[model samples]
Target: MTKQEKIDSFDPNGPASGNRIFGLPFSQKDAEIVILPVPWEVTVSYDAGTALGPEAILEASKQVDLYDPFVKDAWKMGIYMAKLDPKVIEKNRKYRDKAVAYLSAVEVGHEDETTDELLAKINKSCKKMVNWVQERTTELMNEGKRVILLGGDHSTPLGYLEALAKEHEFGILQIDAHADLRNAYEGFTYSHASIMFNALKIDNVKKLVQVGIRDYCEEEVEVIEASEGRVKTYFDRDLKHQQYAGATWKQQVDDIISQLPQKVYVSFDIDGLDPKLCPHTGTPVAGGFESEEVMYLFERLSESGKTIIGMDLNEVAPGPHDEWDANVGARLLYRMANLFGKNAGVVG
Candidate 1:
């Protein structure tokens, strides 16, 4: 069947088939939005399992209903996720074991030649992963397809950001629990904790606006302060205080949206949401936004006339015997895809 026939015949409320993202029937060539899955999470400091996030989300996405009230007939816009590379997954396991040992040694103040060698190897592997992602994303962009990066960790988007920088000058809207500003965190250059710091090095990233940040180190604070308006952070505590002082969420959202450039790239770490929504994420911090709150903000962003050039959803680890985290991630992914498609004029 042609793409239109598949869309017209597919039941929005029916069971999702195996083998495709959100159980959609479209292939890569016909899909308006293409998602690249990066299943590598070697530098995560807190938890393990995020390397499995892409598969988990793919499984959970099958349960998602295609009908979206926010964007009418959102499923009409073809969305397809590329297959995850098994080689990357194997690489993640290899380096993750090394990273675990290296972090263990560091925790006990055991800094020795063996640890240094392991760290160097892990860093080199991470650089290769970045390059792999960059090449894939660049290829997709060259095809004139809007991309959404499905990630293994917060660090997964670094290469996607690099690929985007080559084509567009845009600001980043980071929704996360931490500042992710550590330089060479735990001796790993591409540590998940240093994504924003690495992102800042890109010449085309004009600004970075972070929200729902409740956990960060003094060093990260220094970087945010030092940026001199290049980086704008809305700490979770201050936002709560503002709400307590009678400021509406809509008002705060407006204020947050006002800081972004006309073109924006959304980097969403699942830990940015309340822990109840993502209990398995790597770093679970207290006091975060509700799912609807963040969705409302995204809706506002869409209505504000800002173009969502690209996006990524990251750090969504699944719990053993439970699919809650992936379920949330899948729904959020659908929402983000719909919003990006609508903004790009591909979906109505």
Candidate 2:
């Protein structure tokens, strides 16, 4: 069927169909935006299950309403998420066990030859994951499709950033609870805790602006201080204090947006929101922005004339008995897809 015919036949408010993201009837070639699902989570420091985030979000996305007040007829933009690669999933499972053992040894201050070998293997596997993401994203970008990366963890974006660096120079606007600037949290070079550290190594990433950060270590603070304005952090405590002192969210959001460059890449970790919204996320923090609060920031970002070159949402792990995390992730994905489509001029 023609694209128009498919749209005409689609029931936006009806029950969601199975398989496709948002239950949309559009192939990769027909979609304006393509999402890469990275199902590797070998380095999560705390809980697991984020490797299943892409699949869970896909299932929950079927319930999201297509109408958006912010972007009219947003579903027409054609957002298609790539299927999860089974090879990557298998690698994640394999390295995750090794990572667990490595972490246990480190916690006990036991550094043996076996630990060294395990660490080496885990790092090698992670680098392979990065390479895989870069190759796929490069293909999608070359196809003239805007991309959204659905990740197993924050570390998943390093490869995506690498691919973007080859094409455009952009700054990252990171929304997360942790600083993610540790050199190597658990002796793993590509550990999730070291994502921002690895990201800074990219020449095309000019600046890093972080918000909703309430949990971090002294080393991360030192990294931020040492960045010499290259990194700007808006601590959650400070933002709350500002609000308590009569400063509106709009005022704070404007300040945050001012620190970003003209070209922006949004890195959203589910833990950036209040724990109530993502209790089962890989790492749950105490304080965070409301969903709409972050959404408003995105809207202001678009209105500020900054180009959102690319984006990724990570660290959403669903509960065994509940679908809350995936539900939120799916809705957030939908909103971001629409925002990206509108920014790219693919949606009216």
Q: lDDT at 106 for candidate 2? A: 87
lDDT of 2 by residue, 1-348 (tens): 878888999999898896899989988998999999999889999999899999999999998989999999989979899988999999999999999999999899998998999999999999999999999999999999999999899999999899999978889999999999999787889989999999999988999999999999999999999999999999999999988999999999999999999899999999999999999999898989899999999988977989999999999999999999999999999999999989888896
**lDDT of each candidate versus the true structure:** 0.93, 0.93
TM value for model 2 = 0.98
> How much lDDT does candidate 2 score?
0.93
Model 2, runs deviating above 4 Å: none
Q: Give the per-residue lDDT of model 1 (tens digit) for 1-348.
A: 889999988888899986899999998998999999998889988878888889999999999998888898888889999998989989999999999999999999999998889999999999999999899999999998999999898888888899999888999999999999999898999999999999999989999999999999999999999999999999999999999999999999999999999999999998999999999999898779899999999989988999898999999999998999999999999999999888888887
Those runs of model 1 whose alpha carbons end farther than 4 Å from true positions after fitting are: none
* Residue-level error in angstroms, candidate 1, position 251: 0.8
Worst 10 residues of 1 by lDDT: 44-53
